[model samples]
Target: MSWQAIAKKDLQDSIRSRTLWATIGIFLALILLLSWLFTDGSGEGTFIAAAGFTFLIGVLFFIPMAGLLLSVKSIVRERNTGTINLLLSLPHTRGEMIVGKFVGRSVVMVVTVLAGFLPALLYIFVQVDEAGFTQLLTFLFALSVFGVMWVGIGIGLSALVNSETQATITGVVMFAVLILWPLIFEQAGIELPSFAQRFWLFVIFADLFFLPGRIADGDFTFPSVVEFDEVLLEELNDVAISVGPHLQMWFVVVLVAFWIILPIGIGYYRFSTTDL
Candidate 1:
């Protein structure tokens, strides 16, 4: 069969898998639980905002992690279990195989996201006005983009690593680094020089999941994103001034797209060239 067929088979397999179903069930349960916990008894603006924020925080972080976990062993597991060899024996190129793996995992991720959140989204749309519905759409878009990026990341790691164990560790370590590096650097009092601040900011931007939390609080400025002193700002001023007013809207999206593509691009290069 072709790569599309392979992806379809994998998606069907995941649907039949008990673990996948259980994860989806638990995710749905969490949304229901958080919805009740955050919603006010009065069911007014307070309830809507609280419930929206609650689900946003829960889903934004959880989806990437779930996608990463689902994809962690996409290729490596097949390799470890000798299935990669079997797959290669079929009429498929290595590129087709890895691409199929990514597509399969991404379908699973998007399905998981929609299944978990669509119920709440529907409720929000029914209860809230047009502006709130627009905001919710924005939230969903961000979550989906972020989820796709992690799928690529997981597939990339799967292609690069030699074993399932290595892929697992690599995915977890990458997640931890993205989540904790900024806090760790700040807590350690390790101040980067002025010239390096913009580059550092760029590294931080690579973690798109970071933006949802900040966006939830209605803080969308650079200072809201990462802390910077006068010196660092002065150093990074050239970088910021270059982008100017255009930086606020679509610039963030380009960064997200970059993170999404870079890993898979690099990993596909490695996967295609290497013997499976």
Candidate 2:
């Protein structure tokens, strides 16, 4: 009830700060720059999937960073400046305020991503007509869901941290680890003996953060690498990790659902009970 009022006010503050416009500008520039590279008709043979996938990759990198930037200092700034007390003196309770901040910030992030993504979508429709409507829509949906998840994470981190610097450092480090962990894990046991290398293969299958990137690109099958002997033209069959129906797109939906709920849920619990 009172949450709606707080949420509206939050939206207004973000709008007045022009953060929304700045986010849109970042997306627009990314779309244009990547689109040019993707559609340049170079001899490298860039197809519809390639262009769209590349664009999705950009969305994966930029939108989450934007969400983190928007939210890392959200609550702490208010608290530090004594404005949070003023907000509390209004009609809303702590729970309402927590819910309002999350919802309002999430909406802003979603709208900002959509606005920036549309031009790229339109360009893809024109430059890569073969990409098709359904696939594009699917990619868009995945990107939107991914962005919302990060926004929720940022909001929760904002509520949980004591200072903007801590939230920002944590967010940046987490993002870096999430993006680079697979690369690190890949090289981890390379120098080990075959026995240890075989075990490391199992560790590679535990990649959770990279799955959303697969969803965004519409490539859902689990990664399986096969080594071949070029001179002999022979294939060596190795052990394959067995994955069930649990690895489907619905699995990604579940992951996104957990991300969206868990952070805000914990933040709400803490903020609701913490002294104002």
lDDT of 1 by residue, 121-172 (tens): 6665554344355456565665666677688888888888888889988998
Off by over 4 Å in 1: 46-48, 123-131, 190-246
Against the hidden true structure, what lDDT does model 1 obtain? Answer: 0.67
Q: Candidate 2, 150: how far from true, in Å? A: 0.6
Cα lDDT listed for each candidate: 0.67, 0.65
As a whole number from 0 to 100, the lDDT of residue 107 in candidate 2 is: 80
Model 2 misplaced regions, further than 4 Å = 41-48, 190-245
Pairs that clash in candidate 2: none
What's each prediction's TM-score? Answer: 0.74, 0.74
